[model samples]
Target: MSDSGPSTPPSPDEKPAKVQFNDNFAGKLILPTEEEIQNDPYRRRASSRRVSRRMSKALAIADILEQERQYVIGDIIDLDTIVEADDIEEATTRTRRFSSVVAASRKSQASTKDWRELEEAGDESSGEDEDYLIEWEGPEDPKNPYNWSKLYRFFCLFTVSMQGFCVAFYSSSYTAGIPGMMAEFGITNRTITVLGVSAYLFGMGVAPLILAPLSEMYGRRIVYIIGMASFTIFIIPACVAKNIQTIIIIRFLGAVSGSVGISNAPGTIADIYQSADERSKAFAVFAITAMNGPPLGTIIGGVLFRYLGWRSINYFSLIAAGIFFVAGFFVAETYGPHILREKARHRRLTTGDDKYFSRFDFPPATSLATLLRRNFKRPLKMLFTEAICLAWALYLSVIYALLYMSFIAYPVVFMGLRGWEPQIAGLGFVGILIGTSAGVATDPLSRWGVRRHKVDPETGKIPPEALIWFACVGAVLASIGLWIFAWTCDPGIVKPWVFCILAGIPYGLGTTVVFTNGWNYLLSSYSIYAASAMAGNAISRSFLGGILPLFAPKMYSNLSPAIASTILATLATALMPIPFIFYFWGKHFRERSPMLLALAAQSGI
Candidate 1:
């Protein structure tokens, strides 16, 4: 072959073809000399730039070799001996190919390194931080929460849901034991039920500020396990209480422990799902479990109360708490930072290196003052600033108040007014359950509507408005259920069943809509601050739930069941059109919301 000139130009009509070569080439340059290639600005920039972890690692090893002046032109690249080039031309091409590989690898690796630095920085910042880990800790790292098997997550979800169920159940279980409690304590006041129920609700509300923030410092799994184990351990003291005051104290403490079940669930779920659709499904599952608990609790509490006696409620709670404790051991830490910290821990241990550190490992302590600041300030900020959060909270609160109100009043209407037996009285709860089921059943229609109508031609995303329509249908059903239950109880032949069905209709549909929309709204609107926002919602909804029972008895007695229910149903009816209003104007409202605007701006929306 003829030797070409140093700067030969290509023919005007010819385009230069990309050079290809074997990996094992071990000779000098076909074109530029080593010094010239190194000095080329493009080559220098490409080499200096960040790349894949594997490539960076390879280059680092190559750098060490180069520093030792270890390369022999004729020798094969030892990194992979199988990769070889035959001649000088082939070797030149191979070196370029390997360099290209290194550059590409560095580019890929850069993302992992940048993410790690950010996560570590976040973890070290404060205990209240919520950043998730994104760095790889080798392939299929167990510390990566997403890498955890489905069975593991399901177990966690089940345990939390069960704990929530137990908490709600225990609130009412004392009803069966009230007589025993009164007899033992020489107390006959009707306020004991209120006292017991309020303690649990109060505990739930207060513990999150204390415990949830600590979850940032310690971890979600540890906090849940410790909390639930304490609750189970506290059950022994609560069950054998000789006086009302002792029972009250123990019960309150147990509730504080159980509160983790509800408080941390949304946070955990948020950490798991990355998309709106997945989140909607996850929220739906959680809503089913969370919303189903109260009625199920009442049902189970009544049976345990009647057959096993008042202490049996606590006994069952102890069992549930124990199961949760056992399950908690298997429940991995899902908090993003915690996962990263664990990965860092593993890497440190395996590689015998101190440089590997996770963001979760060094979180600051969230002190009482910080807790107070966060608890008081964040909620106020969210409630006042986020219109969607405020609106959804209001809607859910009203629905919950009505639910608890119904719970308080139902027994009286069926047992006292209609003269039903205790067991038959318990069956009245089925109406509520049936209503919940209806709402759950009707939810798919809303999703289908979203698929059918809300499609954006450009991005193909469903409008959030399509989801709100279910809320309207639910509200209308709630009004109807109220109307039927209100009017059908005059000892007529068709009274009980007709009333039950009517009561269920609205409740089922309405609750379904309420839960679906409320959860989806939180997931969509407050994607980053999902935990704090949901915490605020939990507080508001729980407060309404816990307090409604205090006045429900008096309201039913004074106004009578028909009027009492009608008033509630009427309120629901008035709120029915809320969905339509939101469906039309919701995005505008969100756009106008200062909190949402700030978040959108921050997220570069």
Candidate 2:
């Protein structure tokens, strides 16, 4: 049997971990930093090693599975198969991960389970050498999520994808009902009415701080079910809200409950698909749904608001939420740790062996408060302290804020000025959808770029910087599109409307490119800490999304359409070189930043 002992002792200055890495894990291994070789793999699933809020849910699931266990539970993401995907930075923020807090616990292995005991690829991590362990029956085990039938896997994927789509759709669709809301409440202030959307975003931003730990502790399914149910229930109040305050509060509550879909969908995909090819495809589908849902929301909202009034939009989200609430109940528990514990329980019940135990068989050593504090603090710390985190956080916030701002700007341009009906005006956002589709179509080109880029001679993994070229292209495209949209959107001109609307194609495509590539860039660059960086990014974006819309009505009202948009265009143009700057010098900064270090320890490059 291979020795399960940890790698060479840590230097005095570094923190110690009770983890051991195989000299060769499969054919390739990217050795983990001492930090990546952690005591609690559960924490990593939710935070340090993850992407956005729920993006890391997949990684957390896969990363935990990647840990060698005497009791194997479908080892996922071979070191070389860097688990990366989706423009879900907001979908799965770092603040929502359980590890942001508990991951800091480098305590003894008593409370943790199978995660702690692998002696080698062939053995489990053990406190006692004599304790026997159980592993996968083989690669063919039906219990393994990866080995499940394609039809079943697809079913699971569809449900989770719908969940994400619903959450994203809620974002833009809410903007459409503002006019009805203003009329019903007899409010004249655009900023006050827009506060409804802002409130919803704020709930999404804040609720994850608590949900992150709950999902890890309870498993992802419960969170989804409860969240969906709460979301569905909360919308009822808003539907018949007597005052704007009620709509604002209920929307906030609904969003808090609704966030589970965005927060856990990525992990569900990660849990089900371990192959990089399959995972990438899964994320693409997820990304497309999330992106597409937002743009299409305006069209739907327009028709609903025009025909049934603003209440119809919430009714629609509620109905969708209700359907998923029922569906969520049928979904199986996908958290690897939870699954293993169940398997271990079955073994002990049938065989009557007291030693039958999973890694997390015992209760957690850390308290809820500790988990909360850690999860909350680490991501915020990285947001400010880490250069990569701060830059990406600010960049993504601006991008998302600008998109939300468009909700106000588009209506102002198309409806207020052009004398277009709400139904007709809502169609304006379809351009963005078309642009996103165009962006997704470029995957082949991105793949070619990845292949063409210089690879690590040792690991054969494409460097993270290879993703920057597309980002640069996206930045330029986004700026040009925004500029076109701005200049052509003059309120006084009629012929320019077509040109202005057409500009959304480039803007949508450009934003899609930046979000998608930028997300992957962080994944490749910050091997483990990507979760925190992404979490901070989401928080900032939500903050901006909530606040920026308030400025939109005012800015567009006070300034000429071209001038207002040009101010935004200038910002986009200024950011166009960000990717280029990172492409050349990001590595130097990445190497020096304590938070952004690439854990090149895995050999599977």
**Each prediction's Cα RMSD?**
16.5, 10.5
TM-score of each: 0.70, 0.79
Best candidate per lDDT, number? 2
The stretch of ten residues in a row with the least summed lDDT in candidate 1 is: 73-82
lDDT values, one for every candidate: 0.58, 0.67
Q: Candidate 2 lDDT, tens digit per residue, 1-605?
A: 11111123347997633223334432121213325536546544443223222322333333333321201111111122233232122112211222212222323222222323221221223224224344466788887787888988888888878987888788779889999989888999989888888998898787776776676566778888889888888989988889998988888888888887876677777788876578767767777887888888887998899999989998998888778778877788876656776787788789976455554432233356755786689779988888887887778778888888888899888888787899889988888889988887776676666557665443334566777678788888888889988888875654657888889999999898888777767655554444555567778878887888789888999997778999999987777777888878876776677643323343211
How much is 49 displaced in model 2, in angstroms? 30
